[model samples]
Target: MKLALFADGHVGTQIADWLLQHYADDLCLVVTTQENSITEAAKQHDVPAVAFRSEQQVLDFAGTRSIAPDLGILAWWPQLIRQAFLDFPRHGFINTHPSLLPFNRGKHYNFWAIVEKAPFGVTLHMVEQGVDNGDIVAQRQIAYDWEDNGESLFHRAQSTMLDLFRETYPKIRSLQFARTPQDLSKGSFHHSSELEPASQVFLKQTYQAEELLNRLRARTFDEHPSCWFEADGTKYEVRINIRKADS
Candidate 1:
């Protein structure tokens, strides 16, 4: 049961470490966007590692590998995986997504959850042709309060997602998992391009306080680029921290 891992970031490093410790012999390949902890772990274990810069490189590598993987795991992947690469793995790929399916299907799951008042959670699903329009293997709906901001929600999702992968991957490896298709009409999707327009704060435009606050808190992640406003031919980014009033 050879496996391939496509991963990036902190959660990606965690996933890579777990796989290396538990299933080192079974890990056939490691695909990454940059040299990080994931690549370093693969090196220690002697697993084949490649840095993918383009969709074409991924496709070309797929064609050239001598051993085809039985399954692929996508953890915090940065690229848009197409059907061509999907077919390279014998059993296809499964993704550990940060949002509950049928809601916030694309980028910035944490931001969209608060902005749109959508249900937030983590999902482990089969990676299909569409952007996260995959069949669910398992999921957990997270509870969030008004005090939760973009940074908090993002960390929560990453933690929950990693836990989901830990619990679900064994079932997946044994071929005991099920695939439940997502209803596309019920969910919202966003492209990377959508964030700019949504994050723009028109100083002259009137907005309901609730709506404006939602937008502010949604983009409140300190590490990420924040919502912005322009005045006097200058642009300024804004991020707000929310909390319950101190007793």
Candidate 2:
């Protein structure tokens, strides 16, 4: 598909790089929020592109492309896509969300899924005016383990997303894929601002040290593990570096 990619950070950069490397002939324009590492690399590859502070710039740039795309996919766009701006794609527009949709529908879902012990999956869906409210194209549920932490979950989910696009989006473009409206009742959305609070583990709630340790390992953040508070006037917190999955 000739694409005009609208995206946010690293995922946008990485996915654009993949498309640029594998399907350069089809990429129309790559639109991103700012010039970051991905944008730098995009320039190195000499890809057609635009970086802007607002979605309007992306919209205006897409207007300049005479050729249409077979499928337009949003990898990690932070901004919203207004209807007038998204109709540029002739086939349809699809998006890759970190969490499985109808559930974990918004940002910081990776950390939330780890904390909540929910499945870490990727959702590829049609783009709508609303947040992640679109027809489901494909989703792959990955089991979250006792040792699954925020950064680990993100890395694993990141790897799965491209595989998802390679496997699913192409089929949808070929019309061999089916479209199904999500069960609105089965899912929920969580915003980014709500996730800024840190997780605290209390020793008092623990039934066993091993179980508590297991759950503690499950909720570790990228920079640090969940801070633990003790009944005494001292704290016991762990900063996890290496991921030592149990053999």
Candidate 3:
């Protein structure tokens, strides 16, 4: 089956490369949000790359395109596609999301997962009119170690997602797979850029020491902002390096 891939950032490189390698014969219409490794990597593979200046522009480009997509897979695409572009694909759009669906279905999910001390994993789901709320195609639990930080956890998800994709692709191609409906009661909706470090920390959602450390280690990456907390009118951002104590 033909697949259209949308991706950006470093995770995009891993996902795009895996797709190109596994589906060498599959035609992929690559959509990108910026000039990044995903774009460069797609170019290296000789795949057609369409760069959009903004999310709205993405919709416009999809509107102009005559070719219809069988399956659309989003790999770290910074821009959100509207329903029009989403409907272009007969199967709608699928995203390699970082959080477990019907729960952590929003931005900064990893952070929230660690903060909430919930199991972290990947969700390959159909993108609906709502955010990450479509029916779930497949999911896998992401493992973590005592010393694993956000960067490590992210790479773990990347590799895990690739494996899940390979195993689920045939099912998707045959259109024989069933999607589990998400329970709206367990669903969470996080707004974009909702909370910064300086934002007031409501005790209800705040974590203790080790829990906070675990959260910090599991969320912030080299590109995303680092986690920070304040005490006694002084604010301190988490800076976990190669060497650190468990405590």
Best by lDDT: 1
By TM-score rank, best first, the candidates go 1, 2, 3
TM-score of each: 0.91, 0.77, 0.77
Residue 38 accuracy (lDDT) in model 2: 58
Per-candidate count of clashing residue pairs (backbone under 3 Å): 0, 2, 0
Model 3, 59: alpha-carbon shift in Å?
7.2
Clashing residue pairs in candidate 2 are 2-26, 102-187
For model 2 the local lDDT of residue 95 reads 86
Better of 2 and 3 by TM-score: 2
User: Against the true structure, candidate 3 has what lDDT?
Assistant: 0.71
Q: In model 3, state the lDDT of residue 50.
A: 77
- Local accuracy of candidate 3 as per-residue lDDT tens digits, 1-247: 7677887776776677777777745645777776776677677777666787765665566567654678888877776678766776787888888877776777767666665566778888888887888888899987666566767767777777778877888787667778888887875767657536423344457557777667566555787667666677786656565455669
For model 1, state the Cα shift of residue 91 in Å: 1.0
Candidate 1 segments whose C-alpha is farther than 4 A from its true place: 53-65
Give one digit per residue, the lDDT tens place, for model 2 in 96-129. 8988887778777776675555656988888988
Displacement of residue 52 (Cα, Å) in model 1 is 2.1
lDDT of each: 0.88, 0.71, 0.71
> What value does the lDDT take at residue 225 in candidate 2?
49
